[model samples]
Target: MDYDGILNRKPFSTAKDEKKLMYGEWLTELTDYHRKHCHSYGQLLKHLMIPEHSHMGEEEIPMLPVGLFKDMDLISIPGNKVFKTMTSSGTKGQTVSRIYLDRDTANYQQRALANIGGDFWGEERLPLLVLDSPDVLKNRNLFSARGAGILGFSIFSSRICYGLDQDMNLDTERIQQFLDRYTGKRILIFGFTYIIWKYFYQALAKSVQKLDLSEGILIHGGGFKKLEDQSVSAHEFKERIREVSSIKEIHNYYGMAEQTGSIYMECPKGHLHASLYSDIITRRGKDFSVCSHGEKGIIQVLSPLALSYPGHSILTEDEGIILGEDDCPCGRLGKYFKVLGRIHQAEIRGCSDTYDG
Candidate 1:
């Protein structure tokens, strides 16, 4: 199949049946590819007793636990071909998952992100306001999920401005300058949920000053766990942001470094919708059985973009449920769902909790 052709289609245009067939074929091929190149992944397939030449459905595809990346070098590409290595967010002394990418895979990730993001925010590039300090992206070759996300979404920006200083302090002057320059134009704001809540929103709430960002659209995710612990619900998060900035459009996405480009984005209806580049399944923890609609279980993310690593299908530790498919009120033609939270006792990981500033 022409992968580029598939990517060129509108992100949510494909129906579930067609996507299953196409993704099944491509993902099956990827499994064979990884099994041939990565000895560790090959051993895993053998150990699982999956036949080499047998074709499998999307649900039948074998999945590696997301944690395995933290403990093993799971690269399918040659060492010399590694374009960059991305690590999951981790605090001091905590192990982080490392994802290896070659040039081809990296390019695909960027293209996929473009296609998906365009569907949400439109194809026009807007000025981007990053909510984190610029220091996070200093290490170009090796960086955490926060840096990777900033770089990935930077593609949609006409120009970029960091909202925070090197010390992780919210640079109100810089942000005010950016808003003044882009006045009356629609702008894009990107950040982790916790950072925006703790640094951006709270800082503005305490100060007597308020900035008008009515034309700004904020996209945040990756730290709902911390917010949940603080008793901040999604409604409260958005309400607080509006109280300070009056920015009406707010979206929360769900994704991780393991499947960087295949993010599930939240629609206006407040459900995370899976795109053509990716799919989500909820599975029962005890026996790994597929869950019915509205049934909560572990999240199994499937993506064909992880060619440089055997990360195409991963059983994540997060819990969620499928709301419906091909019938979202948001008008997208794919599965839309909600993430309840991480599995109980699951280690704290992801960009939102890794902030030390």
Candidate 2:
């Protein structure tokens, strides 16, 4: 679907009309491809009486309930061609979504991640400090979403250091060593939100000694429901981290294992933005109709990269408000929105939520 061509374009620079037209054509093609190859998805389409020659706008496209992934092994590719299998971090005793990818699709995912991440990290690799224990990465093939996140971003690492020791305690000496060795260099810090807060930030607050991370770019995501339960807002999260570590640049991304690699990244102005290859739609909870800017509703994410599976148009359990399109104060094109949080008990999913008991 000319994924490379789409990913290579400026992430935040496409015109609204042009990008919409492009996404409509490609997404419609993907709808047909999945309908032909994936039996379960085809049944879903047929049951809904969606015609074979349906010419629907991107907003009118059918959306699968993301929970379907947990209940079925939905893949468009043959078993032997399945390159990798990724599982979502569903709550205990609950089912996790399994996403299948062929080699080409896997490579496309990585390239898409690299392109979007490049917007923030720039062209060069930086010294990376991961906020979790090294043990999480021991299994090279199987991964919890947290582990996959570390490995994905590690592609931009010149050198990598794990911040927590094996016991899930902050490894002061190890982290200090990395900072001391790469003193004054611009480093990248990655971790799930709660881990960075409970293990990293809380540890720093308790310690008499402080380490300087002033020259670092801290990127974290997963879910913030746990934090919200504790009365911590994103603003408070960033402010607390700054107070303890002196790191001014903190970016929080919104992504899921169901739609890996096609993340919505938070910009300088605190809004999560869609890149060139993907888009987001906020739909009214009552009718599933598209919502206007500033109206809160369920989130339906659209990505061309999900064609390998039946996930091209997924109605996620998340709720958010579409702030604007193509005219952010941060100057990024496409939709910019704020995640209001999860809808009910949607299984504490995402990378950060993986560690919860």
Candidate 3:
């Protein structure tokens, strides 16, 4: 498909308020078309055969988790057009798989970043301080930290990386140098939680130079899986970052390689809002019963941008509660939800292994 032309069909350039209308209608129409085209989806729809009228009920979009990406013939593009494959970092079973991403995937990823992240970063060229390992991008492991941001998000900017230290540590010298060089501008500091905490938080605690919070955004996520093991609460992480940097607007986004087109942005109140491109619903308790607003359950996410893959509305392993609707005081609209935590013993056999969705 000529994705460039499809994306350029007047979606992003329109007025800001129209995004939800355009995105919602387009997603619904796209999924209706997508359900008929993709094989796995077609099979699922045929097997269970949800009524034609029950389309927007947040049904699980038939997606083979990253682990099964190896086992199935999941490619949707013509075989000759297949480009790069992005894998996940998780326990590698005998059957491991990589997500086949065509140029369209890159296009979708770039557009989504520009539309959403652009709202946060704005037009100013912020000197970036990437608090991550240099080697993370070099190798091609599924859990490869470095490649994730570069491929999924950071390519949207031109700023360079101030990676880990010479002793393979979180190099404060490099970050400091970048900060010193790029003073008087809002900085963009990106890293996974543990690394950012270990490096910057530890440094701040030790009386190192504090981050200028008045001028920046700290975009970090790699799940709280490993971070919580260190006894760091989400509040503490935010507080410490605030204390060290002094930035009030700290956004923590959540996404996956399975469906990289949409990112769930965290509002200041600590709830992640579903983007215009996707919507979510939760199942109450252990029963897969669709819960009402403010009820806790599993998050089923739906996005229509996947062509090379099928990740429509997927049942995630995380349990969360929908706090409210588009009435956020923070100016971010749409269905807002708080991720309570990951469901225990949720046997999701795949590379994308965060139950806390």
Q: Candidates' TM-scores?
A: 0.98, 0.97, 0.80
The model with the greater lDDT, 1 or 2, is 1
Arrange candidates by TM-score, highest first: which order? 1, 2, 3
Per-residue CA lDDT of model 3 for 1-357, tens digit only, reads 344554544322333346445545555555566566567655766777644434342343333333355556565666666666665445444344456667776578568666666666674555666765555566543434236665455655468766565344656566667777777777777766666776667766787566564666788765666666677778878888888778666777766666665778786777787765566778765667779898888777766566666665566667788887767666676777877656785543322332121
Q: Give candidate 1 regions above 4 Å deviation.
A: none
- Which regions of candidate 3 fall more than 4 Å away from where they truly are? 1-38, 50-73, 91-97, 139-146, 203-214, 245-248, 285-287, 347-357
Which is the winner by lDDT between candidate 1 and candidate 3?
1
Error of 1 at 262 (Å): 0.7
- For every model in order, what is the number of clashing pairs? 0, 0, 10
In candidate 1, list every pair of residues with a backbone clash: none
Superposed model 2: Cα runs more than 4 Å off:
348-351
Question: Where is the poorest 10-residue window by lDDT in model 1?
Answer: 348-357
How does candidate 3 score on lDDT? 0.62
Query: Lowest-lDDT window of 10 residues in candidate 2?
Result: 348-357
| Candidate 2: tens digits of C-alpha lDDT, residues 46-70 | 9999999677788878899998998
